[model samples]
Target chain A: MKILVDTLGADKGYEEIVKGALKALENHNNLYLTFIGNEEEIKKLVKNNTDKINYIDTNEYIKNDEEPALAIRRNKKSSLHLGLKALNEKEYDGLISCGSTGALLAGATLITKRLQNISRAALTIVFPTEKNPCVLLDAGANMDCPPELLVQFALMGSVYSKGVLNTNNPKVGLLSVGTEEGKGDKLRKDTYELLKNSDLNFQGNVEARDLLSGNSDVIITDGFSGNVLLKSTEGTAITIMGRLKKGILGSFKAKIGALLLKDVLKDVKNMLDYNEYGAAPLLGVKKAVFKAHGSSNARAIETGIDAMVKFVENDIINKIEKELAKKEIEE
Target chain B: MKILVDTLGADKGYEEIVKGALKALENHNNLYLTFIGNEEEIKKLVKNNTDKINYIDTNEYIKNDEEPALAIRRNKKSSLHLGLKALNEKEYDGLISCGSTGALLAGATLITKRLQNISRAALTIVFPTEKNPCVLLDAGANMDCPPELLVQFALMGSVYSKGVLNTNNPKVGLLSVGTEEGKGDKLRKDTYELLKNSDLNFQGNVEARDLLSGNSDVIITDGFSGNVLLKSTEGTAITIMGRLKKGILGSFKAKIGALLLKDVLKDVKNMLDYNEYGAAPLLGVKKAVFKAHGSSNARAIETGIDAMVKFVENDIINKIEKELAKKEIEE
Candidate 1:
């Protein structure tokens, strides 16, 4: 499976990316990588392993100093631009970037363009809810979206939940402030009305608190709000867990007890960490594209690659097509 | 302080509402409560308690069973609407409602109307950040909003932070998917540009994970986004803590150790449980208003009343006007 990796964005330098690429190659030798970055950095990272990793000399890497969109506009040779351009030209089955996700997303839409009939692609994340992992879409993909766009997000997320999560009939929900029918704004109100008759599992409305309660499988909202909610949930969970670590294990005996229950603590930590799920799929793109978290470590990158490889091999595009066709029939 | 309480809504019905009202009245004898609901349901709880609690029968009690907006529209006697109407008529310093928040916000905007200078009213909640309490605005007040509306939210949030949180110069931040410039979509881009020139201690955009770490004193976003973030944060905190109580301290050794660390737990819980600070204040209204969680028990109810009492006694309205006028001069 062919996958393009932007080696400049992660906290680790090109060395780690090269090492990760080599490691990914060890498992899947047929795995082709198009590394978009400077030659020297890529060589330094790749060492003597040039056979597995292919380099694309972009000359310029959009620095954190520059503005994201403006950088994209001016720096055509930037790795972000080149990587997405290669993906746009169908050079790879999927594109993977750990760099400025916003830049990646921007470059993806403007370069490769969204899929047919898709208003805009959504970044869908699988959050670990109490019951199971639930799908949250448009977690800041396109901030200003129309009601029609949200409806599209619902359909796309619904298709994703069924295809990925293996839910036979995923209950699609409109994420609003409250669960009532007419709880949200004009956009939400319209989306809810559309979802009600649109033939998806249309679970009326879902509040943010209800996210972890497994009340619904597919929760759709605009990117801005979804992103905020997703991040806030992560922050709150981390803060609570941090407090538990500090507050409970502060004392000598408590600390000793915590050590005794270290296995339990590990289990608890695993439950909270979202990196286990790999990268978020940028659904509705022409080809499968995945975005790793900015703070993602090597393991997350590996998981993302594994997920992409599996997705590419699984022929999920056919599934997406079938789902869209089903949606058409319902409409 | 004269405060209006919607003596209706809650799964517990009018009995708990009135019972909580009586406790609220008993707790603060100087505080006057305009309890609007079915007179008899309130009477059953009010009994001979006539000193501060005055029952106002609006012939409307909003139900949770049906659509919220329609419920508010159909039930003219809904305590939620009537209570807001009283505030609109300049009958109280601030109104507190224990009804559906979506309905209260709708009623607040549609019935009470915003202050003359204010274009939109936001629901603001305070969270205990690393430093002082962090104020988050438009906590699900409206789902769809323009960039200018978010700019307005920042201004209003800054005013509230100064008045309520007692920050001399509260740093206002535009909530985004990331902290980088042009990191988000159209709304964020426009809002970021607008915030750069606005009359605020405008820090750059703040990411969700950094929200609780005190990246900014006041975080402003559209209601739909804010609401989801707030609820998710709250739910994550509660769910994780509950799991800790049951899972972490489930064993006998930990249980024995946990009692010794009760003070630590209490302190940590206090930090996590932001409601202890006050009920969420509805900013930008002509008259100050507060909305508490519908499931709020007695202490939370008192906290709501206490916030309103402080809002009234502190001359928060005049303070907001003075701040805005001063902001105008500075800008």
Candidate 2:
């Protein structure tokens, strides 16, 4: 399968993206990548895999601070815009970017377009839970989601969970203040009614505290709350880890313990590491689009590529289209 | 100072609340507590401290699932209602409840009432960060906050941070999706414009990821997002600790490390412990009202009482009222 890789907008430089792409190419002989941005640097990084790699050199790139829609419309020669355009034209099976999330979503929506019957595409994140890696979405895509948009997110999240994450039935839960039917704000109350009546395996509301407990395979929320949940979780993890490090280094006895427990600590850190989880898929778009974290390193990029390949192989976009179509007919 | 302690609505039984109250009485000689719960049970537990304790015997209480406004209005004889009423009438200096947050907020607003010039009261939580204990407000109170309400929350939070948490010139930040001025949804954008114009040492928009980093002394958001941030942070911390425990127990070598590092780990846990932090004050209320965690133990209750006493002594409500009145006059 061929993928268009946007090598800009990452907090880390293009070299890291290129290195990750090279590693992905090494792992899968059938995988082909088209690197966009700073052509000279990407070419130098992928010198060994020139046969399987393509390059679109451009120093212009959409910045994280740029307005997404305006940036996409204005910066036509930028790597993100160029990559999305190529993906839209069917030059690649999918697109991967460690760029601005807003810009990627905008370009994907306006350029690649949404699937038939899908009003909004969701930015979906897959994170590790105690029981399994669960799916959470619209993780900052549509901030002000109406009830209908939330319903669409729930349906799309369910499809991604089943098709790519390999969850059976994929119980969907609405993120709310409480687990009751009418627990959250107006949007949640209305969406709860809709989800309860849907054909999917709809679970009742799941509170934020139960997010990592794996109570449901697909946890759906509006982008605003979902984004807050995602970042708060990340922030808390960093804080705890920082505290642990400071505590371990504070005393002589603790230093000895830390030496002995180094492996265990590594294991715990790895479990919470976003690098292992790789990319978040922009689901409901006509073509497959995955967004890696902005601070992604080489390893995260490799994992992102692997996730993108799985998303393509599973035909998630087509499956989502079919599910929505089926629901429309049933209605 | 005199305080009314509502002994119902805690997930833990009234016995725990009684035990906590007893501990608080032992710690403060000049302090008085009115226990509002099962009269006979409270009497049995506080028999040793009867001199400092007053009993209002009533088993009636509001449940967590009950609608906040309706529950307060209907359950007039409930412990929460009686306590709020007594506090409202100036029979007590403050009120402490380990009861339903919604019921407490609603009762406090309706019965105890908001401070003059304050439009809404905020549910305020003081949590530990890397630098100091920062105050987060509207932590599930006003779910649908307009820009003006958020400005109110910022002011109230700043007051609590300075008066209770003892942070000087508290930096108030509006929680949003990004740190940029216009990064978040409509509410955030509008709130940003107002806060920027206000004289509350307004820090720009704070991302949820920077919440625990001590970037701001006061973090303000609408109740929905604030609740999500609060619970998600708790969930993530719990998940990490669980993983660390599991990892340590999985190997004998790590078990030895855990044994050696027990004290350090205990210290870390203690720092994050809600029991140490005591209770969250319901800011903007006319009378001092504090809400202890639903799972409060004896220690948490003791600390909560200490916090309540400090809040009353500091005269946070009067300070907030004056601040709001000044702002109104200036406008």
Candidate 3:
């Protein structure tokens, strides 16, 4: 499960991340795809079946309008800093990068860092919601923090919904503007009294109009209100699907009722596809960086390398570093 | 343009608010409506047409899960405090309410107050988007503030995008978590250095995924990040149109292409209807309260009395007290 791919920072470059890493090496036969950047455009998009992909050659990329801390101090051999120096030499258990979300949070916090009692870190994004697909988090990874880093982003988004959305305990919420206990500000009434005296599953204050009534499975906030509630729900679901395709193709009997729901509107646009929940977890990184969405394509970078191979088979950063070292040895 | 309206805080009471004010006085005519409450249940739902419409009894009726500041002090003869005491007796020209958005912001700040150099008051909404319909403001109103009340909520959201979405000058922004000029907190870096030396039209910051793009026609924030970017864009457009209606009714050639796009999925559920832009406009009140969505129905209380007869025949509270007294004499 060795994943490192940046393959020239997204918007589908280098032949759709070398044909989505040869369709995830035909479903992970000991996966190894490294391909960072321009080694003859990823050797003609991984041609001549290049022994299950590899090539960190690099050629500066991070340009989604530069200045992410001055392009990680003027491009230290860029390709998103050589894919955050191969996940800071864990060689690659995880680290994908569709690219330039401010140069993957300034080259993954200057090549892997922030872990012990993580003060600021976040990029969550879950979204399949109707019940489970809620987790929003630092959708804007720290612009300014401390409400005890949103109570450690609600215990790192309920330790990624009880270790990778399996969710048995989860429940937490603090995306504010009232659920009371003297509602919001002073950093959400001091992170709602440190997440209602910490333990987790704290569901108290959540109202941004009842976040799609599947309510709390870890919503958290700050990274500037989870990057404006993950870009105002990705620009109001692309302006309510661009006014539902101009109000159903602006009449002709709503374009023959949108051509009889055009193949069930492309399977309801692949279940409100944010590339069907691909990659976002930047969390309090030690290994998994994730990022994707520099206009991710090829099925959102094969759903960001199957969400970095389900965070390297759900080690989930050593269970969020043993739940922040057992909440720092019980404070 | 009279207005008043509580008709005993709706839950389909006062017979669907007198059948949505006799279907908005049969398409408005410089109307007058009033209707406070229990005048024998709004004269048995406007029977024998009591000369068009107007009532005022009010033996009270608040409940809708009470606690909106103790249901406006245990219902002072309710009807949301006699329809905000007839918009503080200027003989109404504004005052709607479907009921309890914390009892209409604690009865419009303890009965129609803050409009002189308006210190606190917000609730805006108007979203709609796909390039038109923008305005979001403190959509839940004050859940803790200061960055000079979000730089007087970006000059009352640039005088509500030039007086109710007419946008002559608009472009205000500042929702933050990037679009830099010192990315957020400390109230978005002190409201982006007083909206980069004010005189409005700032446009410096805007991320909650570009709040339903049209980019900015007044965005602002803080009402706990504008109620978590208005309830995570109403829970990601009802969780991406309920997984695009169960992946377009999962089955049989997508059920014959979703019955030929049933009028383009009701034009994508009326372009993601947030009650098709009904209430919300309590902006630094002195009149015109608005609110609406308390399960509104009756065509969202006749589009919240046509947004209070276009904010009472468009003199929007003397043009927001002369452009907030000309931005407090140009600060």
What tens digits encode model 2's per-residue C-alpha lDDT throughout A76-105? 899888898898675579999999888988
Looking at model 2, the pairs that clash are: none
* Candidate lDDT (C-alpha), each: 0.76, 0.87, 0.74
Docking class of 1: medium
- Which is the better candidate, 1 or 2, if ranked by TM-score? 2
List model 2 lDDT by residue over B186-279, tens digit each.
9998899999999999989998998888879999999889999999999998988888898898999999999888888887787679998889
Tell me each candidate's TM-score.
Answer: 0.85, 0.96, 0.36
Candidate 3 docking classification? acceptable
Model 2 spans with C-alpha error above 4 angstroms: A47-49, B47-49
DockQ of candidate 3 relative to the true structure? 0.29
Best by TM-score: 2
Q: Please write out the lDDT profile of model 3 over residues A1-331, one tens digit for every residue.
A: 6777777757756677678667766777677777777877667655545676777887778777777878876787887776787677755777777777876876677777778778666888786655677787877767667788888878888877777778889888776766766667777788788888888879788876566566678888777677776677667777777777876666676666556667666655665687777778788878877887777676767776876676678887888889889988999
Worst 10 residues of 1 chain A by lDDT: A256-265
Rank by lDDT, descending? Answer: 2, 1, 3
The lDDT leader among the candidates is: 2
> Which run of 10 residues does model 3 chain A get worst, by summed lDDT?
A41-50
